[model samples]
Target: MKYLFGPVPSRRLGHSLGIDLIPFKTCTYDCIYCELGRTTHLKDKPAAYMSAKEIKAELDTFFANHHPPVDFITLGGSGEPTLNANLAQIVEIVKNLNKAPLAVLTNGSLLWREEIVNALLKADVVLPSLDTVFIKTWKKINRPHPLLKLETIINGLKGFRRKYKGQIWLEILFVRGVNDTEVEIEALHRVLEEISPEKIQLNTVVRPPAERGVEPLTKKDLEEIKEKLGPKAEIVVDFKRPIEERAELLNLREEIIALLSRRPCVLEDIVHALGAHINTVIKMMDGLQKENLVDAYLHNGKRYYLIRKGER
Candidate 1:
């Protein structure tokens, strides 16, 4: 599964099967809070990063296999998926599979392009992030490409809302001392009204971020922000559904390694992802830590595990 990873747990999409279309670290913005680290290939132009035929073939094989039920067939992994020039073709291919509702998780930086917006029209849901409304804050937080403009990006989102019929869940990730100021929030509130997304999801740093000194806001802070954003807004909480039981466990150790290699996960995330008992996950973590294959760090109140830097 070179391109696809996880029927992994998601707070918004339930158990999402992720499809990676772009190469690792290729994105339009290099945000400080990115869990997968900094964007190494920062470009705005879309390219044929992977063959659509190969992706479709992988999806075909995936549907043929007996696996856990997934809520969404998500097009997002490692980088900005919209960077793949074959986005519309890939979307068509996934919709043809008809396994589950398709969703696109993007940064929404390129949605200003008519072709990019048109390419996403077939998706069941589009989850795009707009971290800030002010150009200064946007630059400081998102660190977007030189060519990107806040006004243009906002217009793109507004235009997309007008044309697309599917639901849009616009995400705004808040980082303390950055884009969480009263003026910034007020500006965002005004812009969000114009964008008019079906849902406004507020998120913060839950995992280890790319840069140091990046801090998450309190639940209290998020609740207040939600209040300010009105009825359509809600805090993006952790996935709390009961883990589905599997008749036969897959290679638990390898699965854990594969997951951690992509992004750090807490104990609960590992349990939910593998559908294994917490004790079992803990034992595996102990072994991996002993082998120096993985390492753990505390963020906020929860502990997160990831593949050791040297191992990765």
Candidate 2:
């Protein structure tokens, strides 16, 4: 369970079983709006940070359990997944398992590399983020590595689209006054047309982000952008469907603490992660707070819960 962290609910992928390939915060971009805090190991090079053997062992152990059904086995967590050198081998391992459809979530920075594109060819679906088309806004929002270029990333996406046969759900996260300008949207619309993803998911900051003052766009704002982006575009909404029961979720305190240690989550996130009722999660939070095991603070109207530092 060191790498596999959820059959957590996802708005796009339903109940996704997440696979963490890269180390925590090891990424190509240190985006201001990232919910998992800042990127600590910012690099563009792909490395064997994790071995295929280790991933295979974890997936085998996970599948051996009688767990709840998951919609997709997603290769993503903590940081950019594409940076893992054993991506193709890991993808093959998952495909061999045949438990569920495999999906790769990436920042689309490394897609310009032919090897990276080839490595992802076996995935059932790929979700890549393209926050902005403009270099200034791209840097402002994504804070990408010095080696990354907007043009290269776009070309990579376009190249991948040409070769890959699977579904591509392209994500564009809008930060108010940063990447939400009229000019950038129009440019993005043009670029998206060329890439031709099956869906264009428009997202804004909903969770507590790495930096302060990073604001989310309103529903009205997103709707207008969706209209401009045309029929393929849809806003990424919160996952509302009830989660299927997992037999092993007996210890709510441990589960909540485990999730929070990875990243601060709202009550809704805890509910989805644990597949527990909202009221149940609320009660658990209250108990944890009283026990001094967890602490919460409000950010942009959302209360985020986290494990108290140095509290085991």
Candidate 3:
């Protein structure tokens, strides 16, 4: 309840239960279009960011109830999860509790470390973001740590590919005017060929992005990237999410408030948990907040929701 966020429906991961290990914004890069906004502590180091025991205890509570099933247990939430020294331990615990595949969505900065790669080997899926291929583009898009080098990151990814056994899904999040150029795409192509990921997921900024009006890549531009990346590239439309029933959808927005009374749930986590359409959930959340049924707060750049009493 404290560390686990959701059994939310993900377009990529299906029903995902999120485990946030590190403190908010404690990542190596500060992506411009990050839904969580600007990074505060832009550092990536292996440390005891959070305890494996604590995370395990949270999972124990959730599994004890065993109300619903999740498609996967995801290691991502407030910050880059790999920074937490206990990530491997957390992954093992998640696997023991829920046999569902454990997925980790990361920025891919730390893949250079063998220890990190070894830690992540048991995961079913590892979604790593490589926003740009060239160093300039990398800086423009990710704004990485002053000490982090593009070459090192690339080599690290290559090394990870050779050693890691799980399926690697490479994610490239493009901002309109930042790293969407032909040259950048070509570099990405080369990198993709080297990484040989099982999938290439193309994405864009659609949420309350860190910078407003960063602009979404036009259909034509996205098409060009898709063509350049060849058959491997697949664009994840900024919109659309997993949902089944409208009645269940409505209950999600209301139930979400009660659910978060135990832990903070993010926008994506809520959508995944309820398996409700994102737009529908957003509209209802707006109305609920207008009536003061729930509370929305930003912690270290990431927004989270919780139920507020004496309102709804």
Candidate 4:
């Protein structure tokens, strides 16, 4: 399962099967709050980061033995999945193998290129990252590659929206003390107004961030940010309702719990392993805590999730 992992659930994309085409954090930006840590191969353009044939072979092997089906074949993990040169080909192959929709989880860096835009045309969903709308704050928070330009990326987004006939869910992750200023929110609001995505998902560091300085935005702050972002904006999600369970999720909750049993972790680790969402995690943790299977603690100013007595 080199490329295939977890028909894991997600707050945004229900039952998801994640496809990691790029290696660890080989992205266009070194975002401050990335769960997988810093972007190691930071680049502004796309390249042959992984072999398309290899990815397809991996998927062939995965779908052969996997169960249930899937809501979406999500291009995610390690870094910006678009950085993989053969992404378009991979998506084409995936479309042939499954009835589920396909998605690309990106940093919104490469959308400026016409070729990249063409490549993603068949994808059912595109979840692009827009952490900051202002260039200064964008640079400060996302720390994009030297070759990257904010205006160019924005144009790319607009171009993609005009051409692609799929759902575009824009994500804006706020970091306390850095990109969470009132001014920054206003800038992001203006940007959202232009992009006009089907949904604007507001998020924060609910996990151990790549850097110590990065922090989560409070619920109050998130509400304000959502208001400013207008009608399309959605606060931290709550993925509780079941969606006819696509993909094989047998032992998913158990496997996630087993992982947590080893050590205390925030929502990101769970998301990393299970492909679930933070909202789903909040619900799962609450349930586990009620059953005395999990414990909650705070370290420094951040929260830590751990296994409870007898459970560990």
**Candidate 3 regions with alpha-carbon error over 4 angstroms:** 240-312
lDDT of each: 0.88, 0.87, 0.80, 0.78
State TM-scores per candidate.
0.79, 0.79, 0.77, 0.75
Query: Which digits, one per residue and each the tens of the lDDT, describe model 1 over residues 1-312?
Result: 667877887889999999989877899999999876778899988988998999988888888989899999999987899999999899989888888999999999899887889999999999999998888888988999998888899999999999999999999999999999899899899999999999999999876577999998988999999999999999995422212322132378889999999999998888888776453466568779989999999999899999999786
Encode model 2's per-residue lDDT on 191-277: one tens digit a residue.
999999999999988766789999989889999999999999999944222122222333666788889999999987887777764
- Residue pairs with clashing backbones, model 4: 69-247, 70-247
What is the total number of backbone clashes in candidate 4? 2
Q: Candidate 4 — which residues are off by over 4 angstroms?
A: 237-312
lDDT of 3 by residue, 125-190 (tens): 999999887888788778898988889888999989998888999998889888887777887898
TM-score of 2: 0.79
Query: Model 2 has how many clashing residue pairs?
Result: 0
Q: Which ten residues in a row have the lowest lDDT in candidate 3?
A: 238-247
Off by over 4 Å in 2: 239-312
At residue 68, what lDDT does model 3 achieve? 76
lDDT value, candidate 4, whole model: 0.78
**Candidates 1 and 3: which is better by lDDT?**
1
Tens-place lDDT per residue, model 4, 1-312, is 556767876888888888888766688888878766667788877788778788888877776774766888899877788887787788888888866889888888899887788889988899998887678888888889998899898888888888989999998887888888888777777777778899999887775567886767778888987877789889853323222332223356687678887887876778777776443455567667888878889888778888877766
